[model samples]
Target chain A: MSAEAQTCPALDAKELDRLRGLCRQARIDLLRSIANAGAGHTGGAMSLVEIVTALYFRVMRVDPARPDWPERDRFILSKGHSSPGLYAALAARGYFPKERLSEFDVAGGMLQGHPDMLKTPGIDMSTGSLGQGLSVGIGMALAGRLKGLNVRVFVLAGDGEMQEGQVWEAAMYAGFHKVSRLVLIVDCNSIQLTGRTDETLSLAPLAGKLEAFGWRCVECDGHDLADLVPALERAVAVEDGPVCVIARTEKGHGVSFIANRVEWHAKAPTPEQLAQAIAELEGAK
Target chain B: MAETGLTYTVYDADHMTQAEIYGAVLTRLGGERPDIVALTADLAKSTKIGKFGEKYPERFFNVGIAEQNLFGVGAGLALAGFTPFISTFAVFTSLRAAEQVRTDICYQKLNCKIIATHSGVSFGQAGTTHHCTEDISVMRSFAGMTVIVPADGIETAKAVAACCDWEGPVYIRIGRGFEPRCYENDQYDFQIGKSIQMADGSDLTVIACGPSVQHAVEAAKVLKAEAGLSVRVLNMHTIKPIDKDAIISAVHDTRRIITAEDHSTIGGLGTSVAEVIAETGKSCLLRKLGIPDQFAIVGYPDDLYNHYKIDADGIIEAANAIMGTELEADEDWEDEF
Candidate 1:
């Protein structure tokens, strides 16, 4: 279906291990850059590490050198506040030089406050406004079908951002059209700005509702690539309709003090906090 | 095309509406260029985009009643290299999907066309919710957005075809139905940001866009015969990159001017012309005749136009009143804000 052959197929043990190494280092990169800027969203970026890592390295069929290869698979960071995680993954995958990661902060150009398709090479669509990325993925999937190209579309949506009505509007459109090769992974980080999503506007029984909306729902441990890789493979195999993988992740996952802490949602890491986060991730080595 | 009961006769342009021409031109463009696609937010029959849906079923997408996603999807399709034409009522596209239109489409400068039908008081009896008199004011404020308002069905066809080749985002506003012909035929040349001088005269210039242009032309004819006034009529079809030269030249040629439209005078064509006149430091007796800064009463479009003094007789009256007023002295404007 795609021009590039995958040397790393689904459920490959060695490949999964190699990808996990990148995820940890990418987490290190995410923590360092946002910390360097003295401002940015750290919690959501840390939370989306493994899901974006698996999609960029092991599962997706892509070439970092030719980012605009018409048949290349697409990854849209629907929750664009998690741009640090996406940037780290793209750099690890060789989308651009690793040195370019320095451009992600207060002094912005190559990387804006939000992901811009015009600025970033590997970014498929520009998305900052929540609940807009899914429809873009739907449009790309529809375009792929029309052109007879076997291209897969992936969207990383925040469970907290699910309160926007546009998300359901896109969900209904995707299910009704039966757009295959489109996978939506909701990063259920369980925390958002102000408070937890359920406390703000409940979207519990979310899986049951998505299933009723004509989607094949799967749940997995977001931090563990072993659990995430196989679930992602299952999502791509569904030809009847779309797939929604509910990745139950903890906000600020890698750092001990910030994990599940509501205050870390958009707060910058202080110098002491950065040293502690670095030590926590490095202790795993 | 399958009949949807929206069909009307072309009885010497009396029953013709701009939406019909929009439906015909869109279906034709889809056949000619496979890259062209049509979408409507549950307004296929009402906005007349159903004709394209029937002709190109595979290329058409009805995004249900979700207008925000309609715009978001249109931007996505444009990014995929397809020219997407989004059709819906003006009130929803400008207000409901304003953020989407601004961030997703205009900010990114996507090549998408928004055909906003039932603008102004075209859906007069449908009350304030359906009537969109503020679309012009809102759409013109967005950067890189080309705003156009066609006078009748003939101009609608021409403007639709012209925007197909124009780059960036375009918003073409039109009335609901029966928008009487302002041009004799669709054979004349049409440009995006240029105004057409319908009638040439020296006494005064009457500038109008969309629904009011036809009435202004009729008023110009009446003013010449009865009042012995040689008036100039300008069909200001494009509102954004407005013809500033035409307005300035009108100030120099005929110091008395009147602007009209079926919208609030605050941000529509009238305000646009006033800015040019004020900038050029020309002291002209200018009167903007439009719906006052208020919601129009629920009634037929004709009755509302008559009441608001946007009809032919009302335009003739405004043209006469402006001619008799004294020109403002260039000393600081003793103005009304």
Candidate 2:
């Protein structure tokens, strides 16, 4: 039997706590990975840490040994700049050796600036150009439905990236097709590369827009596990059409100096800043 | 006047158009290749890919009116390991979704087959926006793209079957509805880059692709009977890795060449053939027959083809014009070179 199967029956509460601890370590690892690179998207990476943790740890039916398993659930980081967080989560989940984290953005490293499906382990699609990933995810889901495979497809989109026209096209398609097996998580960090989303282009009443597009829109504090777990469960429970989880999150949630700041959108922390950030995260525990 | 009932040989019928055969073969191929997914951008019945779509509803994707997203989604599906055949009018697929095709499929080098229909003046009555006169030039310009403009429906089927084994990006252009069939049967093999010689002669050569290949062959017959012109005809289907050897030989032997295509004279077959001829410095008379620099006038496909002088008469006229030029004698050629 597998390690997860062997440990599933016993220690239910303990396992959940351990998973949360794993998420925390992933957050720390993300900060370090970005700090080492010296040029990475820190804010959005930090914002998506908990959700990435939850999926890799508790929800996703993945086998690191069998990455290409036909029935495996696919996760697409549509908001691809948050590679540091995804790499950290993947490492924690044992998709690759944790030591590979040090090679992030190094020359000849498997980790590129954006997710390359060919280079990285467990990456389903190479996504960096905004608004293209959801379409890919929908195709995967459609393929699964056609093949009668019970695999689910998950795509995480940044609120800023949602401004792209193709995203809405994908949304309308997913909704119209009633792709029940697909889940879209919008990392509503409110900040983009330029400035705030409202300042860049007003996407206010975002949930209403998604609802009008025929998705079951779920709103929750992205960082809060209480709200997140239930919202995710509800999304999975839906039988018809796609589900959209509007995850309201701070651009940088864990660190005090960087939290809610637009400057940290893709800026890496200095050595002192990294130390300060680690200390703040440790204090939260 | 004697009543003559001339019998055309089976070999003559064998050269039916590829566009008609593409529809029939795709439908049959759909029955066998379950994983072969089909997509259209609201031009299903018009492009004739609807035959395959109707046969295999579960495998077909009609994404409505979005051409850009059609290619993007097709790339995505190809990335997921599904063999996706995206069909639409040539103008939209080549020009409208040109960037998406470049970045998503060609740049990434995905295994997506773009079956662009209504190419050239095939959609003559639909006016300039719908006619795909520039598709060949546009598709040929992209790196790592296999561009094929099959002569008829029979050739289309052969091209479609051939593209299945091709391991990278492919752009196959077919004519609009009721295009004259050009191939003989399923027995004929279709290679991506190889040119098919339709007729052999020594006086002048006519190189053509797509619907114009038939015209070139017809023109060869007319030239032989009326003006005693020995014309060689070549169906230059594959434009990208154009049969350079055939062109070089044509220049060496015939010395007069006319390139006919249902496209712009600028970057299509004319330019492709010119590039080859210029490199060899062969003393050859060359004339390009295609849509002029101006926008095409609105009419039926056949009328438009005639209006643009891309028909058999046009090819014959071009051949005559080039044949009128004196061949450079060996005495004068050596000094010029």
Residue-wise C-alpha lDDT for candidate 2, range A131-194, written one tens digit per residue: 7778778778888888887778889999999998888878888888788878899999999998
C-alpha local distance difference test of each model = 0.86, 0.81
lDDT of 2: 0.81
**How far does residue B315 in candidate 1 sit from its true spot (Å)?**
1.5
Writing each residue's lDDT as its tens digit, candidate 1 over B154-217 gives: 7787788888889999999998988767876545667889999999989999999988898999
RMSD of each: 4.0, 5.7
Q: How big is the positional error of residue A210 in model 1, measured in Å on the Cα after superposition?
A: 0.8
**Residue B183 in candidate 1 has what lDDT?**
74
lDDT of 1: 0.86
Q: List model 2 lDDT by residue over B24-52, tens digit each.
A: 66777776667688887787877667778
Task: Give candidate 2 misplaced runs (Cα > 4 Å).
Answer: A1-38, A98-109, A268-285, B1-20, B76-80, B141-143, B181-187, B202-204, B225-229, B251-257, B271-287, B292-294, B321-337
Tell me chain A's TM-score in each of the predictions.
0.96, 0.95
Query: Over 4 Å off in model 1, which ranges?
Result: A1-13, B1-15, B328-337
Task: Tell me the native contact fraction for each prediction.
Answer: 0.48, 0.32
TM-score of each: 0.94, 0.86
